[model samples]
Target chain A: MTMPSVSDSGLATDAAEGSVVLERVTRAFQGRRVLNEISLHIAAGEFVALLGMSGSGKSTLLRALAGLDEEVEGEGLIRVPTARSVLFQDSRLLPWESVLDNITLGLDGPDPAQAGRQALASVGLAGRESAWPGQLSGGEQQRVALARSLVRRPQLLLADEPFGALDALTRLKMHALLRALVGRLRPTVILVTHDVDEALALASRVLVLGNGRIADDFRLDLDHPRHSDDPRLVGYRQRLLITLGVTESA
Target chain B: MSAEGSTLGGRITSSTPRTAQASSRPGGTRLVPRRLTPLGRLLGPLVLLALWELAAQTGLLSPKLLAAPSTALITGYDMLANGTLLPHWLASAWRAWWGLGIGVAAAVLLALASGLTRIGEASIDSLVQIKRAIPTLALIPLAILWLGIGETMKIALIAGSVFVPVYINTHAAIKGIDIRHVELARTLGLGKAVFIRRIVLPGALPGFFTGLRLSVTSCWASLVVLEQINTTQGIGYLMNRARDYGQTEIIVVGLVIYMVLGLASDAAVRAIERSTLRYRKVIGS
Candidate 1:
């Protein structure tokens, strides 16, 4: 089935850049199909959250979009901007490099150091430029990872459970930080997560992946700074949880 | 009734205090200090030396077999004053430095080749493993046949022994680098040179230093064995000559020199390792 075009979706204007389109993307491992004939489209400046159970292929779809699935057997067309960055669950910072260096790593053009400093400042890590990755706490490391991702001014930002390893309080703080950053950067973001509350908290559109296909796709029309206890969010959360085959106890 | 109540209250309060003190004392004692001051570190060695001196003075220890610490020290000083120690020490140091340098260079090149490429691993790794199984001393016979008993053979033996630890550790470290970082590099569009410079080299450093410590010790060890092979001007040669004259003090001096050299080189490597790997969060900072 064909998906709606960006114009009809009314999510973004610059459909030419920072947009992702996939058609009949099929990924398999050991004769088992993880993603089968899955088609998806994301517009520029859209915050899309992909939710799935274990082995539901949410990460696979994200990897394919990021062009990191070359070693995996897949047959499909994936169109993504060349200027894209991926944030994994772990910070993935080079431990030997300082925070500023990690941010500016592979950055081009004149005075990349200034840009790196600004990026660090933006993530509330202004004076931590010389700090090693091992010296920073987990939450701090994730913030540095966020800065590194946004430093390049990537057109598409693909995150695979970036805050999964953080504590609950840290996760809440990161959720807010990510929201503010994504708001300002306006990059098309695809956040693959298992937490329904996180998806509802950050994403404008949420998609549930199950049985190697998109099982549910819907939009949350809530305003910014969404509360988990909001009745509308509660309704969406319950439906999403049920779609994920998880029943909430009364 | 008032006396009975007062005695009961005093007994209860006394038991509570004792229990609190017991609990607090264990907590205080549980925190054993792990760090030692420099003087504290020297205490054991100093005590051992004192005991050795006492044994020698009491005549319980034979000077014929092992000279007293004082005698060894005087002998060492005499050798230093008469200029007999400098040339021999220099010769051994020179041999060790050349051998270590060559071995480290070769190990780095070989590790990069084997660790970075499939074909290099297929061709080089197995050969290194095979060489590792055969001790470098075992090849001294063959080396003597090939290069003859000279500086060349001595250095060759040292280099051959030093190469194994460095190559094995470096190659393993390169292979053990987090694959996620490699993926990050690709996503960041890093070229081959940049990836090697930023990721591969730094990632391999800790392992390389570990191997280097082993290599340094091996350099001294093989030198001792190599110097005995018809050498005229190394510590080993001096010790061999002393063996003929039965001058045990000079032999003790030779042993002391080797011990100091080995310790100093290892300490040097450790300093460099600490500076380079300061990023790591290890015990005792």
Candidate 2:
């Protein structure tokens, strides 16, 4: 199935150097192709959301880009900068280490603690360096994870259903924090999620993957901190839902 | 899942949620304070002692078979006064201590090699399995022949007894490390030394502690058989002497010392567990 291409209205494509470029990337597992002949160019500072059904190769593509899944069959040229970081569904904090130590983990600097503190403060966890990961709530642990990722100041950030485990209210609040942080950092980001609203709420450009390829690309030129109730997001939401093969009723 | 969850600090999206709780201080790894002891624990031992005393006083139990608590206490005091118990107690303690030291060292080294390296595991694991099957006390005859029924034979017996438990526990602990944590180390590009220091050692500590407790008990248990290896020193020697004279009170005294030593070592391990594993308690009740 193929999606009809929409006009790229108000989408700025001038003088933006590509930070990540994928050329004919294909991945297969035991004779079954998951991602096939995928190609894309993500400019610096652009936030892209990858929307797809389960097993549609969204995560496989993401992992391939991270240089983790190198078993691709074809000449798939994936160019990612040295400065990059990834966040998973769970916070994945080292339970043994304190909050601050987790942030400064693997980070080399004259004063990693100070840098971790600043990162924690940015995530609204100013004095929580000494607390264990188990002490914090789920959301707070994710915040520490965010601080750990941002502590390195990576140029590219990849997220895979980070808020899939969070509640609606927490998810909304996290959206705001993420938008604020991204606006400040100006790094290119590729967010992979099954949640269409999340993509519409965050991504400047949303790509829908189907049959191991990008089925549709929707460019939302909305302002920052877009709400779920905004009329501008309604059309994109409907299109995404239909593309994801969700029926109105069973 | 956000890219921030990646240990490698790879590509991530900034669109994830941030409703994380920043303040619940639940699972801190601070030193945990000891809780109050329940009365039930002391009650059991006291009741057992009282039952023995009652039976002895009523003559329902013969003194030859089992000495009364009062008789044992009086014998212990008399031996203490005459300085007969001190030398035996000292010798037993020394043997147990050295056996534990040597066994623990060898076990840890072998466990580390077996746990971390395939070659080490392949070479040492089968041999250890064979050693584990044979009770260390069964080697008494061989040990006596090799080391001449002196301090060497007794110490070797205790060491051999402790080795298997220590090795099994330590090796199992090392192998039982969570795969995710190892992935985290690799993603972080941690060096071998740093990985061993930061991940391997701390991860295997609880297992090692468990093994240490077992080693202590086994070492003490073996000391009984070891000191009997034609030795004229230690509590075992004292027991043999009492046996020759048929002085059951002195024998009872020696038995009580061994019991106390076993309990003391067990308590020491518990204390270490409480301090080192305090982090596990930090989770909200």
Best by lDDT: 1
Which residue runs does candidate 2 get wrong by more than 4 Å? A1-18, A70-75, B1-37, B145-148, B282-285
The global C-alpha lDDT for each of the candidates, from Candidate 1 onward, is 0.89, 0.80
DockQ of each: 0.70, 0.18
Displacement of the residue A121 alpha carbon in candidate 2, Å: 1.2
The TM-score of candidate 2 is 0.84
Reference A-B contact fraction recovered by candidate 1 = 0.80
Per-residue lDDT tens digits of candidate 2, residues A1-250?
3311112111122223438877776677765678777888888888999999999999988777655553344335567766677777888787777889888877788998899999999999998889988889889888888888788887788888888898899898888888899889887889999998899989999999999999998788999757778887987888888888986565
A1-250: candidate 1 lDDT, tens digit per residue: 3432223322222337888887787887766789988888888888999999999999988877776766676676677887889999999999889999999999997999999999999999899999999989999999999999999998999999999999999999999999998899899999999999999999999999999999999988899888888999999999998999988883
List A-chain TM-scores for all predictions: 0.93, 0.90
**Candidate 1 lDDT by residue in tens digits, B89-170:** 9999999989999999999999999999999999999999999999899998899999998889888888888999999999
Each candidate's number of clashing pairs is 0, 34
Off by over 4 Å in 1: A1-15, A229-231, B1-17, B22-44
Give the C-alpha miss distance for residue B24 in model 1, angstroms: 6.5
